[model samples]
Target: MTAARVGVVTFPGTLDDQDAARAVRLAGGEAVPLWHADHDLKGVDAVFLPGGFSYGDYLRCGAISRFAPLMDELIPAARAGLPVLGTCNGFQILCEAHLLPGALTRNASLHYVCRDQRVAVESASTAWTGDFTVGQEIVLPVKHGEGRYVASEETLDALEANGQIVFRYAGGNPNGAMRDIAGISNEAGNVVGLMPHPEHAVEDLVGAPSTDGRGFFTSILSKLVNA
Candidate 1:
């Protein structure tokens, strides 16, 4: 079978598309570079919206990015069962696109936070998280200011009931996200959005002792390969 082609989108000011592409290649998939202005998805099997200060984080991290021409097709494609993973600023785009729920606000401390953080896998049902066991702990890096996630009590309750909360900070909360929520998934589980930088943790030589983040890429690749 041909290797699954994973599209990594690069918007103006995007900082991690290259890293995401490298991780995709390392996971045995083809990395297809996607421009923000392109209308086509280029026949990729899956897509990743990498973290970055797109549009220089002008109005908000992903506010401007959500309106990009590519998203006009990408959003519908994702809703049609195409696997889409959004990290950090990408996560912000997901929220902005309404593909995922909740809004990210400035950190409670009012400062940009960057660090190696521990997060518990709250669910293993998503395309990007199937390799992890429920309650598994993984280390990844998170860098952002408007990383704190907030929602109404009703929405929080709905997310908890549906098991859409995918990851939670295992130790102390880094950005004061409500209930330590670090990541979440859509109801179908094909789309996932997280505040951490998994691409940064894929290499053993560069990141923490364990290559926990590699599972995210491998999990999606395995799913596509099996399908």
Candidate 2:
């Protein structure tokens, strides 16, 4: 099978670009490196916005990266049904770019948090989450200072009504996100944003041995293959 070319975009301050690329390779996809400043998406089958304090998180996390030249193409591609995954700070960029709804804010405790967290798959229909059954639990490393997800009550209700909530923190909430939400997908299921670093958990030797994060990459690959 020809591997799907998955683009891992690197912004000015991106910290997880290489890890994200490795994850894509582990998932049997061709990992394509992309630059934030580039206007082209390189004709990749999928895109991943890795985590980091882009633009030094000036004013806000992902606030500046949203204006990068790549985003001009990415935003339209995402809206046109291209698959895009955003992790942690990347999630912030998606929200800032308006690709995904809701806003990520400082942790209620105002602390930079790092831990292995569990999240339940609330919906399996998205392009990035089809590998897990609904309600499946996955453990992954989460390290961030501002990971709390918030939205207006009306938007919250709409997300629930439309079944857009893709993942919810299990057991206990780590960041005080509304409803313990850890991830979400757009109505089209092509775009997803989450706060956990699934790319970091793909291997057993370096990080968690549970292999919870591998499914994230595999799921997306499977979806692309089957499509």
Candidate 3:
């Protein structure tokens, strides 16, 4: 059987495309490179937006990249039920594009934090989180200055009621995000965005504290294969 084709979108300043691609391959999927300036998806089964300072985070993290040519296609597809996963800077893009609710902001301490953080999976029903179980804890790398997530109280209540909150800071709230939110999914559960760098924690050989991040890639492959 052919491996699932997962497109890894690369914006001008994307820094984790290669790592994301490698994680896809390791999860038994083919990683297709997607250029931000292009109009094609190359028939990928799913899309991944990796971490980085897109457009050098000029106006704001993910602000400029939100209007990239590729997003023109991605936004509709995501709304039409194509599964999408965005991490770190990619998370910011998802918000800026209005694909997901809430926005990321500067850490309360006004500092960049890079660490192996523990997150508890609160909901594993989403396409990218299916390999996990509710309450499962995993360690993933998180590095960002503007990573705090903020949303209206009503939005937060609705997300919680709908089980759209996927992950929460387990050990500590590194960014002072509201309700310790580490990740969340859209109302349809197909699009997910998080502030962690899962691509960086997919392998043990790279000195990652845990290979737990591999589940994100594998889960998407399973979703595509089953569908």
Candidate 4:
């Protein structure tokens, strides 16, 4: 009856590692600190890549961090169904790592946006979103400059066919993401990436009074317990 152990990876320039770990703990899981340079996963049940400007956003948003030593282990583990969740810059890293398909590009408006966004859960079968119901709308904070999602038409069709599209902007497409996509999961539904910071919305005393983000952490813990 031990708590589920969730690893929160911290890449250089990562700004949300502590917040992500706090979310894990608030969800009743044990948060394991993981470094970008570490080659091992430390036996955690699942891994989370928090939002940040890794590698100082050099080259591209997540280009450099994708090759981090820890990613060497993470990539394989995620592919093998280890359950991975990436938010914001972490989402960019997931795409760069090819853990999830599609890519996050510069916002269509060419402006950095930071706000509480309403998104609908398009697919809840993913490990990180199982607690949510399909089409349920929730509010999460999004802060990023390159948050627009782009993919080929064929890829978009396939993602739709496979139910890989996880979340979509509810009211309007803030960043002009293709098809209003805000988040998506891999084919196996074990790995997910999103351009919003769910960790930032988990506490009521913080900026927003909504705790909608807590489900992301709890959902994974539930999946681990059931496994």
Best by lDDT: 1
| Cα lDDT tens digits for candidate 1, 13-119 | 99999999999999999999999999999999999999989999899779999999999999999999999999999999999999999999999999999999999
List per-prediction Cα lDDT, in the order shown. 0.95, 0.93, 0.94, 0.94
Q: Model 3, range 1-227, lDDT digits (tens) per residue? A: 89999999999889999999999999899999999999998888999999999888899999999999999999999999999999999999999999999999999889999999999999999999999999999999899999999999999999999999999998999999999999999999999999998888888898368989999988999999989
State every prediction's TM-score relative to the real structure.
0.98, 0.98, 0.98, 0.98
Candidate 3 residue 187 Cα shift, in angstroms, is 0.9
Our model 4 lands, by Cα RMSD against the true structure, at: 0.8
Give lDDT: candidate 4, residue 151.
98
lDDT of 2 at 157: 94
Ranking by lDDT: 1, 3, 4, 2
As a whole number from 0 to 100, the lDDT of residue 220 in candidate 1 is 99
Per residue, candidate 4 scores C-alpha lDDT tens digits across 153-224 of: 999999999999999998878899999999999999999999989999888799375789999999999999
After TM-score superposition, the amount by which residue 124's alpha carbon in candidate 1 deviates from its true location, in angstroms, is 0.3
Badly placed stretches (over 4 Å) of model 4 are none
Looking at candidate 1, the ten consecutive residues that score lowest on lDDT are 204-213
TM-score of 4: 0.98
TM match of model 2 to true structure:
0.98
Clashing pairs in 4: none
Candidate 3 RMSD to the correct structure:
0.7
* Candidate 1 Cα misplacement greater than 4 A, ranges: none
The collision pairs in model 1 are none
